[model samples]
Target chain A: MSTSSTPPAPPPSNRISGTAISKEIRAELAVECSSIKSTVTPGLAVILVGSRPDSLAYVRMKKKACAEVGIDSFGYDYPETVTQQELIDKVNELNADPKVHGILVQLPLPNHIVENLVTSAVHPDKDVDGLHPLNCAKLVTAQTHGGSVKMNWKDLKSIPFHIACTPQGCIELLDRSGVEIEGKRAVVIGRSNLVGMPVSLLLNHRNATITIVHSRTIDAQSVVRTADIVIAAVGRAKMVKSDWLKEGAVVIDVGINSVDAPDTKKGYRLVGDVDFDECEGKCEKITPVPGGVGPMTIAMLLRNTVNSAKRVCGI
Target chain B: MSTSSTPPAPPPSNRISGTAISKEIRAELAVECSSIKSTVTPGLAVILVGSRPDSLAYVRMKKKACAEVGIDSFGYDYPETVTQQELIDKVNELNADPKVHGILVQLPLPNHIVENLVTSAVHPDKDVDGLHPLNCAKLVTAQTHGGSVKMNWKDLKSIPFHIACTPQGCIELLDRSGVEIEGKRAVVIGRSNLVGMPVSLLLNHRNATITIVHSRTIDAQSVVRTADIVIAAVGRAKMVKSDWLKEGAVVIDVGINSVDAPDTKKGYRLVGDVDFDECEGKCEKITPVPGGVGPMTIAMLLRNTVNSAKRVCGI
Candidate 1:
């Protein structure tokens, strides 16, 4: 089978291309953009406090994706030597900016500064990443109890974007690969709000009886195997093997781990948490790393930013 | 071994109890109380809307428990005809009064008034039952992100008292029963915050691997069977049979279920979610219904109320 016309992995562990879905979304957004000439392009302010190569790369990818989707990117690059108050001030500036619809400080902030305080500084409406405490309160408890948004974005309270994006990407992959999610058993290996918990909510909303297995969980492998869908986000490489999977279970590997893949020229290759080689024949569907959920996450962020602006602007 | 030792079951499933452990907890709390003055009692205000029989029974039980614990009980029985605004006003009045340390409204309000409005009205410090949204925010995602005073407290934010009571009971049961919670395969058979969710958090805090399986979960029996410690909160009659349990698993059944007992006077017997008949000689330790978690829950409510008063009064 030629690489160009190989029918894109439908034979075994079929991974649906995120590019296709993202393209459709971009087209819709473009139509929306075209309809309104005086369009308010949603502005995202990303605060990078440290010089971690990975975090910078991730931020860069996000900015590039934002540009592709018609969202404006505002970068706030600060040195590690900066004090907590200064960082908080920068967040406050972004929070007050009428045009700024989103603010995200990359993880692993300086130890001296309180990350939560700074993150909370961004108004909930501009919390496109939805990492704010208010957003989390809504997610874990009930959406109805969401802390008051400073703006008129009534809809932002309901759309838990940051966590929802990753979960949505996982679902999109499965759906596009022809995997059945409704009324099927699904096990999410991890319970952090960013990935596991929200995925469980989405899966539950979609009618999949979901089990959330965390580091504090027992018989996690057995739980994962029973699921028609298995989403492993536990960062550990190859933690989920074929033997632990039920045959034909749709696997959505959310962990973008870079293990010692010295065989490749980049010194290390991108590998998912799942043992992809072993999983291909065992599962009916699986999302690949680098090209799978990675692309989808950034695309979703842009979509969220646009929506956030629209809701707050009442446009 | 004898029927006299095993008291009658109640509700949807047998709520597993530690007759031995409850005795131990009482003894310990008694010891703790011996040092503390009885005059400085925690005040619990029970406010009920309407005359639902179940709600009435719950309030009565709470009042009775408060009496036993040397706590003052202020009962306010309101009518079903109360408007949402009037209820809010009443709750605000309770919120402002220093005399009222803890306020509990019997749940399933007349469907006309917003449940969230009434619940969120209680102040967090005075929310001894711990169901307030702000308090729940404190539990799930602590403010300032990584600060980690991160207490899951007595309950899920919904019926804060509901979870706070169950969590306190579970913690007490485990301690008295001598079950090591750390690194245990703890399977919580329900996803509710009142018992299961908070229990999961408590177990996680204590360093246990946690798996939450519910009705939509593929094989709940298999999941439950693998736990080092099993907590059954699903209100199903004998849903967790002996075979579903591992040989030496510590069982905590939180369900108070009533099933058809043709020989009993009420035409049914009360039981825990676990089958007591099957649990005997199996688990190293287990709690019995009627006297187990049920009493412990009441005890904890009294304790939390006292604790809430200490915080609210700055004593």
Candidate 2:
């Protein structure tokens, strides 16, 4: 027994540094982009079916991010009167064009065009947003292609890009904040196939013990109270109250809701799904609304577009 | 004051009769099968890789069930030393075989073959057990496809029967016993996709409020204690103690566990996942292991096979 003996176990530390982790991952992605062929500009297509100002603002930020990452973007500003068949035809046209690698129809469509038709029409391989039924299937099951009946171990890398952007952002946020996903207890408060389901699958793949709570889950709040990591994405404004949060738990709030706020000059204030006022002292780390999961969603959209282009071109 | 007659709210009755419900379903299936062409035989290719005495006995029972139900059964008995490649080859051969409408490889294959591999190879349309990745995807996203294409809705009749055997059996047991599934609080223990996942999906579709719990879930035992209906599918011996069960909660034990019972002549005895001794006075309805989900599994399997043949021939 010498001075080189192992040190004693240190006291636990409380910190949530998700911002740094996300920044580092972004930096790594930026480096990877630069290392690849610099002149290959990734192309993204955004089809808007209406004049929803909110959708426009979201699309504008995404286009700006594309510029930042050397990706070219195109947008189709269609009137609200567009028919479902017309929108589907446009998506089909984009799907056939070799120049267009990704197709995204800004959601909240004019209610005429069935969203399912638009989602299904996009080629699965080119589905960057991962909303296609086929893509969703692929994300859950590691099965191989329509070309091969057998699942090749290597085929996993070819999984379609653009899973639920908010969930993808949540994963990045957790990793950046130094939260351990492996074998940790994670509870997601929602069951939408979009974010809750995909995020749960991703977390399950990473070996984190996961539980999904829906409206039917009786006393689901009590379940959330025990989670090491709690993801509030129920779309309900501050439904996950402060009491439900486990002490020092890393929180990833994926909901961007705007409640009535006449006090602000803008007439409305942005708030995440979590009650920020109650969570400040209890949570280890939390993302602020407007700058948190929102930005990450746009960033991931660009990333998925680039990824889809790379796979198609065999880059 | 008008002396108008008021309708009485139905009293909470212990009406979920599990045994009677199962019998009712079997009888109903018999009527449905008889009304159709009796000559319609759903052909099943049963691939047995090993010679486990218990497994062999199960196979014989399945063959007997098929015969009882007017199903055409073909048994492929492979040696314990069968290679994974050989198994895969056999499955492909059967998949292409026109006569074989459904395929089932007896589970717990010898050490050489990966169970997930052989099981997944069974064509989704012909997959009676609903274990194929395609079916799994369909279940998750509510899409229908027998294979790697847009499967026609007509193909559904020919597709492997949607045999919610055990879960369906639970419904049968309840119906026979006069239990109501609609508008009841249901708690499912275990989250295995094969049982818990599908059952929860079925229950959700039926409008019964459901809460699904698994190993990752916190206080699973406590959650079960409050349920009106509890489904124990976790393959743990005596895991769900009677104390955790709600008063008069209908319990469907899906576990088949073998525990030491030197007291019995066979040197060991069969036991369900639940402690029936403790459940004697507590549970309103309970299914024993040997006669419970076991028989229903074979019954549903045969039903699936017959339906498969019907769809294949467009009957």
Candidate 3:
């Protein structure tokens, strides 16, 4: 008769918050940065074009993160009308600068300026975003060429170059949270070069059975349901439902979608590809929309800058 | 009941042969070569550092294949004592030669010479093997940048670069044979940069659900059995058996393993990764050893040389 008196235990929280994990990484990076030579701080050069509000915000956040880690941040703000050659010239100059260890050009450059041309201009050694063809090629070939059969975030130190930040962040979160990826089924939605494609490759490198479901993928839900790990990057808001997930599936929501929220003071709110409310209890672990992968991106960029600097110093 | 003797219909032969397909492609190339401006023919430079019988035989075959397609062949034979710098100098020399439209450094170079350094020295524009880091990066990002979402061999022209010959050859054989790859389940065994890794990425570009089973993959057979198509590139001999395939799976065996055959004149016979005897009648389609994948590789290399020459001449 007294059994009803026992209060229902609060639903155990399995939220894998990227904010906390990123803080841990940033703290570790700060210690590493300090332990390195005090004479020269790791330098990160960023070139931002066409003052898009979001891109500016992202660039600002990255610079601030660099400062927090005791790294030198150099900024080059250019007008939207900057010629491709001029941008390439700036990149080449940065490439030759002894002070700069890593270089990143804020993405979504002016339509006239080809993204690939601008991104590849960054020296492969200093390409913190890992977009340069040589770096990309190295990432592709590294697994088969003297690298580990399975990739883990801890193993990133052994890799000679930068990895795409967002994907690296996604993996870092999963890895830090103690989720086992080896021998697991991983489904990556979307196949964009920046996120889906590279993450899939990284997962494959980690010995996961990977399935990439894109725009043309048939039965996307059924395919996703088979995964132990699900990475949604289709830029769709709350598209993944409870049914799409298997019991105890770990979810890494990479898509950041803005949706109308009448009740909010701002009139809008950011949501992820997975419906967080439905998935919170169902999933073994899930990342939140605003506080999850969003913060880790900048943290990874800082780590890449430090690593790039370490390489130059032959540490 | 009267018993009438009837011959069992030999299991419908669904074997996809590479020799016949290569001959067809070479014939087409020969015709194209004759129709093009004949003043300056396409030329291929091959640098062989050692006289390993297999390497020499491979170089000779490549040279002979080039001749059949009206391409000029330039050979550079060096002793095993050659230094890495000497090999690199030779590559650089050929790279600057206007007559050399494509350059291939025969693989398994002298122990002292690094394969990647030599392979990368072949100017990317003329890297016929597509082993250069830039070319490998281009292959990785090609789809995300300008190429189609789902890649097929026919779309190779739009990529504006040469793909790894062996992997491209596998896809070409499958495509030309009228096998549909769209939305199919594909399992690629092995993750070698030259074959398994690139082919898996190619199949993913073609909208197939790709599962790559490498040395670290657990329960490899069960993982492979779910595929509608399986590509076996692990160098092991006869590792893929009938049980490893789905009932109607299309198999592309890229592995070429030499096994001792006491009765054979050479005392050894070439076999693919699949146990063809058990698979010949069990699967819907399968490529055979010796005549499968082997010839197609040389044919694709010839195609690449011609394409490179065309690019230089802006044909």
Cα RMSD of all models vs. native, in order, equals: 6.2, 8.7, 2.9
- Tens digits of per-residue lDDT, candidate 1, B75-155, equal 988899988778878878888887778888778888787777787787766666667765655555433244644444322
Candidate 2 second chain TM: 0.82
Chain B TM-score against the true chain B, candidate 3:
0.93
- CAPRI class of candidate 3: acceptable
| Tens digits of per-residue lDDT for model 2, B18-113 | 344445545655666566655555688999977999889988988876766556789999999989889889999999998888898887888666
* lDDT scores in order: 0.71, 0.70, 0.87
Candidate whose lDDT is highest: 3
Docking outcome class, model 1: acceptable
How well does model 2 score by local distance difference test? 0.70
Residue-level lDDT of model 3, residues B1-315, one tens digit each, is 857688778866799989999999999999878877565689999888878999999999999999888999999999999998898898899889999999998888766666777787788889999888777876777633432344444577556777889999988888988998888888899989899989988887777878788887778998899888899999999999998888988999998999999999999999999999998777888999989999999999999998998888888
TM-score-wise, the better of 2 and 3 is 3
Worst 10 residues of 1 chain A by lDDT: A148-157
Question: Quick one: best TM-score, which candidate?
Answer: 3
lDDT score, candidate 3, position A255: 95
Worst 10 residues of 2 chain B by lDDT: B146-155
